[model samples]
Target: MSQPVVVVENLVKVYQKNIRAVDNISFYVYPGEIFGLIGPNGAGKTTTLRIIATVLQPTQGRVLVYGYDVAKDAAKVRRIISYLPEDAGAYKYLTGLEFLELVAKLYTKDPKKIEEFIEIGIKLSGLGDRLNDKVKTYSKGMLRRLLVAKTLMVKPKVAILDEPTSGLDVVNAVHVRESIKRFAKDVGGTVILSSHNMLEVEYLCDRVAIIHKGRILVVGKPRELMERFEASNLEEVFVKLVWGA
Candidate 1:
């Protein structure tokens, strides 16, 4: 639909030990949709996201963002995309508001736009007066929320997020999830994220690809896959595909 905002075809990645980290997988992400690459740790989900974000080169195949090749037109792809890695850390010494303001300045020279970004970041973060506190004083959940705000506040057309809610408690994860949804719906940004959390995928993604050992076993809406597999939930569908039969 709408010419597919992101496309990955016959993607492959290999390590020095001849490990095929990603093996000829393919998928498409439509504009303004939340798409998820779902799998456990080391399933090559992060590798795939890195390729789309233009951070890692694929050993084989191609990735395109808004018709720009990730390898051939990396600069053009990077112009419209933002990437947030799983282990991203905030500047510990800076106050949360200061960190957000810093990112806003880096992304734009226009003062009005910079102010707009910081405003959006503050609302997305939902940190209130605590944003005045140094990042070093923040809890794990608080820091993660701030990081999420920074990533989406850039207003990138495409956001590549690796484990967006990883390691957060339930309340924090829910907040982060709502922020992601707002980015796609209110900000009109396309999102492609990786996570092992089946419930998160089910609740957050419009469609999903089930990945394991660098391969995609299935791709569809959560409810569609559930009905197709005759399962009660996405996790049950995953278990049937990866372990059953």
Candidate 2:
């Protein structure tokens, strides 16, 4: 088996007042794969992603990205990973093109590479002339597309996305999902994303971890889980596991 690009071992996170946002959960994501954390709100999905992204430190256990400990070697992990939060926002004052160019510059000083990155961002976004419009003018769906493009364009070894397609209409949701698939398939990018949308997780992830009440209840391919639970789909399996239906 190929080595995993990301690994989490018995991870735990506790907030103030001893609120355990994430319990002892463990999972691994292989290269060129899209792995998902599926759960309802406050189920600890975002908390786990944040710990992996180095945005938050785990109270116990560890997350390793490409052999670098997220807490001990945070700088190295940051160099290889890009994190997009669920409520991620763009610079509303800047035009979409300007934002991409700005982010590209942050990644590299070479003008050629900057242009190359921006081109990739534009391609991923599928926002043609609208790129010229200021981000403040974009619809909710359009802004999300731009943000997703920004997250993937730099070509990080690992992409951590929280609710990548949340709150978008059907057309826009499909666009975001396709963009995610294209990045993983074409660039061999490794992605770890959290989503409450079962269908989206079913379509996008190579493997999935069903999280509930801060603990991982199951981790498997969608079909495997469906079969194991004797359910028709991931949604039904999730209900059976979490609600014990």
Candidate 3:
């Protein structure tokens, strides 16, 4: 495999009351691969992802992005990666165009690139007349589309998406998943996805690690994990791991 784009070594995080949201967990995501951290809600997936994204400092251990330590080299990591949280809320007051412009300004100062990104985002989102409207008035699906577009605008070396399709209709969910796949393939970037949607994980991830209660229980290709557990789908494998068959 090529150089790992994302690496986690016994990463751990503790909250205000010393609740260990993420225990000692380790993994590596290779270049151009889609890696999924599959687990139930409150399974520490979000906390782990937040630490990797550098939004929150890890209580212990390390997360490195493209050889840059997330803690010590946060600036370099930020430049090379984009992360979208599960509850990624936009400035509601900003129009979709304005939002995109703001995002573009952060990583790309080129007006032309910003304009091009906005054009592509508008077209890709199929938001039509709504692009001029403030995001506060947009529907959930529309908001998701815009957020995804905003993330893609960076064209980073790695993209971390937390439940990217959490609340979309079947059609929109498929659209977002396909868009993520295409973005990774086109840019040859790595994507780390945390999702409870088992089918989505099976379809999108090149390899998956089943996480539960802050620790990984299993890691392998979806099919291999399924076959190992004598299951027919990812949901079944998840149940087996979480409930102990």
Q: How many residue pairs clash per model?
A: 0, 0, 0
**Model 2: per-residue Cα lDDT over 1-245, one tens digit each:** 79998999999999999999998999999999899999888899999999999999989998999999999999999989888899988999999999999988988899998999899999999999999999999999999999999999989999999999999999999999999999998889999999989999999998999999999999999999999999999999999999961
User: How well does each candidate superpose onto the true structure, as a TM-score?
Assistant: 0.97, 0.98, 0.95
Runs of candidate 2 exceeding 4 Å displacement = none
- Candidate 2, pairs of clashing residues: none
Clashing pairs in 3: none
lDDT tens digits, residues 20-67, model 3?
899899998998899999998888999988887889998899899988
Question: lDDT per model, in order?
Answer: 0.93, 0.93, 0.88
* Model 3: residue 74 alpha-carbon error in angstroms: 0.9
Model 3 spans with C-alpha error above 4 angstroms: none
Candidate 3 lDDT: 0.88
How far in Å is the alpha carbon of 27 misplaced in model 2? 0.6
- In candidate 1, what are the lDDT values of residues 87-204, reduced to their tens digit? 9999999999999999999888999999999999999999999999999999999999999999999899999999999999999999999999999999899999988899999999
- Sorted on TM-score, highest at the top, how do the candidates line up? 2, 1, 3
State which candidate has the highest TM-score.
2
